[model samples]
Target chain A: MRTDLLRRVEDRLRSLLAAERDLWSGVHEGAVVPIDALAELIASGGKRIRPAFCVTGYLAAGGDPDDPGIVSAGAALEMLHLSALVHDDVLDDSGTRRGVPTVHTKYTQLHGSRGWQGESRRYGEGVALLVGDLALVYSGELMAEAPRSVVPEWNRLRSEVMIGQYMDVHAAAEFSVDPRTSRLIARIKSGRYTIHRPLVVGASAAGRGDLAPAFEEYGEAVGEAFQLRDDLLDAFGDSADTGKPTGLDFTQHKMTPLLGWAMQRDEHIQALITEPGHTPDEVRRRLLETGVPDDVERHIGGLVERGCKAIADAPVDEVWRTELADMARRVAYRTS
Target chain B: MRTDLLRRVEDRLRSLLAAERDLWSGVHEGAVVPIDALAELIASGGKRIRPAFCVTGYLAAGGDPDDPGIVSAGAALEMLHLSALVHDDVLDDSGTRRGVPTVHTKYTQLHGSRGWQGESRRYGEGVALLVGDLALVYSGELMAEAPRSVVPEWNRLRSEVMIGQYMDVHAAAEFSVDPRTSRLIARIKSGRYTIHRPLVVGASAAGRGDLAPAFEEYGEAVGEAFQLRDDLLDAFGDSADTGKPTGLDFTQHKMTPLLGWAMQRDEHIQALITEPGHTPDEVRRRLLETGVPDDVERHIGGLVERGCKAIADAPVDEVWRTELADMARRVAYRTS
Candidate 1:
């Protein structure tokens, strides 16, 4: 069931994607350069985690494989996640993603090749923004096509994710940061959307009853663990493994695990953050130099372990436990 | 009848908004920075073109509001439209909207007061993105809740809008500027999504019989007129009247009615675009110094007149005719 589960999800996703392709039929035909490139980039190897989560959540809630609603909802979630990645890459000025040149980078190269100046950055970002919007619209459309009822979860999920994202950005802007605040930010930003809501949405769509509290508890714990794992990867992970630049979060002065730990133990970490004239890389290294301190690392390690354990021990069905166990282990030990 | 129509629509919108508000009940207290901001901004402003068109299309297709499925389907279109606006502001980097600070601008100001460096911009965009996402999800939820029969149209509408957005962005990235291409961009980017699909969705949702072709014809004509008017306004409209930054499209070298004309006529315009080195304003002034040629303006004026007339002449009900007539007149001569 476990091995077949991935195959099932991937097959459904492939078929859904073919249907979704019609959404951009004109542009894909018109401009062979950017539109086609973007489409290809989107369909390129994605973990499809959002879709998988949707599908998994549905199955865990006793949904049937033949249920077309699962396919639509899963596809919608995947589109939303992809859309966010497109926009986020532009915002972060990232040049590569998932081991390939990012959409902005490809467009920038195309613009340069065509000698289109001034609009290189603007065009890249603008096109990326539009692509993101398109994905967003399509996601909704796909979900709307689902056979099951989706109103209640769909309505609330939209608002919650947005609010959480806002909170994430706002918290990052703070010059003075603390652990409690950072945790709060993480919860809003990831906890509800990635784990909590997806599960609830899947369950609700499948007509499962009273699954909320279990999903909620598991989501919060595992969500925090997921974020904590991400922070570690950002600071210490191999770029080859993560497909992202190392030390990015630290360099950007993003308040994350390494900095949070350093700040708690030493005043010097504050000086490093407060001081001007340091490159993002320099700050990241400085924060790391204050050292994860065996005790601090241990603490973060404990939190992640505890969080994962809580998820594993939740009252969810055995499938959840099995699925979450793998995720937890990966989170705990993976370099990225 | 018109008064009642407006009141009923308004009341339905209020109820929808209320339902949406409740969706965020526990997680979103104290989140309404301007208590009536979204409601007022959406309610009192613009033509309720999307919703009305959707309803009209639904009715034309022999669908009925009295049919349990039509209401949510109609409302979903509105929610999707609302969500698009939230994200659009961020993409446009807009400040004021509907005679007030946009969502991003409002949030940015909130961060600025807190001494958050780069906080305002980041926070604003983040919040806006979140809000847009929320709208996207809610739109799906509404569709799912609606009577399941109209699902096909809802799905098609969703996909069409996204494709339209991608085309808009793709056209903006072009190095070679052509009037024809620009027109196509305008149609796909703004026309179909703004007018065509909304009308079709409305008629479809209402299950009106044999109205598809009429909606298409009416939507295409009106959509073109709407976009043409927008192009004229961008170039000639007073900032005070338009409530938008003057010459923004020109500065961005965006393909619009004004620039599209210039791009087609002059080699210098092509050179200016191809190798833009000077500031955007300098280029704008230089282009303007070539002056608004009577022939060029006349050409643009001709297109606008044709579009407006087409919309006015399209076969539809008396109520729609009057509305289209008023819109055409307003679009044809309005400064903004």
Candidate 2:
């Protein structure tokens, strides 16, 4: 049932883009560029983790399998993620995403090669800005098809993500925010936004608002695990599998929780990050020597356990509980 | 009646920001920065044209003046405009808006003064990007409170504006996209988006979708007049009254319709614009000497008459038609 609905979610996205492409193509040949950018990113594979959780949440809450609103809610989550990623890439100055040149990078190069009138950097980033804005708008359009009851949760989810992102950017610049700020950002961004709110959005679509409390607990635990895994992946994972350049958090001086721990153990890590001529390799070795990686691994294990416990008595079927447990393990352990 | 509704619109905006300020203040000290930036812009002042058109359309369509949804819808239009302005300032690299420093400029200076970790330009623009994103989300939240039937027009209005912006940016970069393309953008951006759609959204909120055709005819005519008047104002108006620097269009080499007309008469004007060392005074002199400004003024007069005529026989009361006619004249002949 989940698979069928997920397939429809993909269909919904494709059809929406197709319709837009047709609508704009009649206006001007260049009118479809932003739409094309969005479609290409959607075509390029993403884990669709938000959609997966949303779907699983709906079904687990006894949502009818045939309801199309679930599909729309799921698709809206993915579209919003695309919007965030596109803008986030600009914020991070990331050149590549999902093994492809980023929207900004591609267009910036286009401007330069074409000898466009304005600064190529501005033109490129400007295009990315509008594209992201369009995706953000499209996400709202897709969610409009969902049940009206999903409105409150969806609204909270979006505003929370934007606020969390703002805080993240501000904290990275200050570079001296307390570790508690790092944890709070992690929970706001990863735990609540990526997991908890999506699950509740799905549950609400299925007429199951009662599932919110349990979903929040489960989401917060699993979300932190997911984020910890992300930090570890960025530090220790492979670029080939992840499809993005690793160690960006390091180069950008992002104050990840893992980095926070390493800095606490050894102050030199800060100079290595903030100053020039130091490689990511040097920072990696020093982090390992701090024994924080081992501690992080153990903490991730405890988090997964806690996440599973959250859903154990969530008024769901045994099958769903077991499935949720397995999903938590996958989220906590699997690499990008 | 309109005054009462407009007052409610202001209250809605202030109270909404106050609520958001309180909500995020509890989270972190710095979390309220973006929300505050938005509030400052709203409080600074704008023409509130879109909201005025929306309220007018609703009242003319016989929508209940007591309907809280109209206030929400009016607030949403203004919020969306604020989002566009914040982002537009970044794209244009403009220093001031409404007599205050643009959000990006203020934050960029903050980053520089504080000796923050990242590039000052990136930090400031990133802040603006997210601040604009928040406003976009907030607009959606506001619109959700209106009648559900406004969805389709609302969707089309948003996507069209984004695409229109993308085209505008692209046109500004390529420095040439044919006269027809410029007109299309002007119509898409000013006519359909600023006037027609807002009016239709108002009518839709009042359950009067059938009024869209007349609104479109009137909006397109008046919107074009508005854009032309804007061009002339940028070229000739005083900075003190507009609360921003004048002649930005000439400095930025924007392919406005007025510039298009001027270039057609004297090709030297193009060189004066695209190259440095030539002042806006020189460009303005050449533009006026070509006598295109006179023609544009005459064209604007024709447009206002046409706009009023489009709604002369609509089912609305005679008072509304007169009020709309007065609005058209005010928009076309405004000094600022």
Candidate 3:
């Protein structure tokens, strides 16, 4: 059932992007590249985890599992995720995403191939930025089609994610390594948007606004676990499994809970954080010696168990409660 | 009356930004910087011409002059313009705007002063990009408050400007200096959003959707003249008068109609276009020798005349017809 819902969301995204491409192709040929870039980025593989969570939340709140509206709303969440990814790549100077060349990288290559004037880097970044903005606008357009009752939640979700991103980026730039700050970033950045808001938005769309508080509690637990898993994957997961090169958090000296824990264990670890010219293997080896990943895994297990308990206690249908619990486990233990 | 309306728009912007700042300050102190950056950028001076045009358009279509909705919608246009300016400064690597330091520059300075760890330039640019995105979201939020009937036009206006920007950037990158491409870029980039869409959106909000065709003709003529005036200011106006350094168009090899005219007069100017390391004075001297500025002035005169004539012929109230004609003249002949 989850796979089928994911397929529907994919279909909805493709059709929406196709219509946008057609509309802009009539405007100017140059306008088509950005749209095409967005479409390509979306076509690259993702777990569609956010959309799945949204669908499950809707189902738990008594929304029709087969409703096209629910699927469309889920697609909007996915599009919003893509928008963030495109901009995040630009921020990270990432060369690829999801095992494919990122939007900026692709545009940079296009600039070089065409022997374009001005700095190719500038042109590429400009195109990528505009493409990201376009994706954001399209996301809003899709959400505008959802039930009006969900509009405030949609806006809140957008604002929270952006604010969380600012906090995350600012902390890294400032070299802030406190565990409290790290956890705060995780809660606002991933915990809320990834799980809490989606559940609330889904519930609101299902005319189950009353269920939001309960879902928020459940979402907070699951979302924290989700981010913890993500941090672990960034540290130790295989490129083949995660579709991302490992140890980026270490290289960037990202202020993750794992990093904070490692720093506490050995003050020498501070020098390694965002240390210039450190190889990923060396950083990973040093971090592993601190046992931070194991500590994070234990925390993830506790949070997943807490989330399952929340779902069990939620005032939801028994079937959906069971499904939600299953989902919490899957999210907690997923390899990718 | 126009000055009073401009003041009201400014007041509206201040209140809105203040509310946003307060809301985010509660989220995380770090998130407040972007909001503050946006507020500072907006507080710096602008002509507020877009809002004026919107108001004029609303009144011409018989909308209530005292309605807060018109002012709110007009504020949305200004916010959208702010978003574009913030992003444009990042793309151009501009140091200042309106005789004040640009947002990225201010943030860069902050990073330096605070002795932050990461590359200051990267931090500044990232903050600016996210701030621009925030402003864009705020623009949409304001528009969502406008009458639902105008939502489609709002979407079109946003999409057209973004597409126009892509075209402009693409031409600059590809070194495409054709007159046709330049005009097309101007029409979509500035002409539509600046005058055409505001006029249409204001009219639609006033329940005068029937007047769209006539407003489009008037708006197109005026908006072209407005952009031409801007190109002239970029090339020839004093920094004190224009609040920006002169000859940016020449320095950047911006594909303006004036550049097209110069290329027509002296094909050798093509080599000089986007020539690296040439001083702005040298490029200005070469372009002036081509007499393109004078030709552009003549073109601006014709467009202003045509716009005024369209306003005269439009099927709106006679009183507003005269007022709009006067506006076209002011837009065409402005020094700054």
> Poorest 10 consecutive residues of model 1 chain B by lDDT?
B27-36
Q: Which ten residues in a row have the lowest lDDT in candidate 2 chain B?
A: B173-182
- Specify the highest-TM-score model's number: 2
**B1-336: candidate 2 lDDT, tens digit per residue:** 999999999899888889989998998988899999999999999999999999999999999999999999999999999999999999899999999999999999999999999899999999999999999999999999998878998999999999999999999988873788889989999998889999999999999999999899999999999999888989988989888899998777789999987887798988999998998899889999999999999999999999999999888989999999999998889887
TM-score, predicted candidate 2 vs. hidden true structure: 0.99
Which of 1 and 3 is ahead in lDDT?
3
Error of 3 at B180 (Å): 1.6
Candidates' DockQ values? 0.43, 0.89, 0.66
Candidate 3 iRMSD in angstroms:
1.3
Residue A258 in model 3: lDDT: 79
lDDT of each: 0.62, 0.93, 0.82
Candidate 2 lDDT tens digits, A258-335: 999889889999999999999999999999999998999999999999999999899988998898899899989987
Which residues of candidate 2, in runs, are more than 4 Å off? none
**How many steric clashes between backbone atoms does each model show?**
31, 0, 0
* Fraction of true A-B contacts recovered by candidate 3: 0.56
lDDT of 1 at B151: 63
- What does candidate 1's lDDT look like per residue over A243-329, in tens digits? 778766654556765577677767676665656765656655665667673544565466556655665655568867778666645
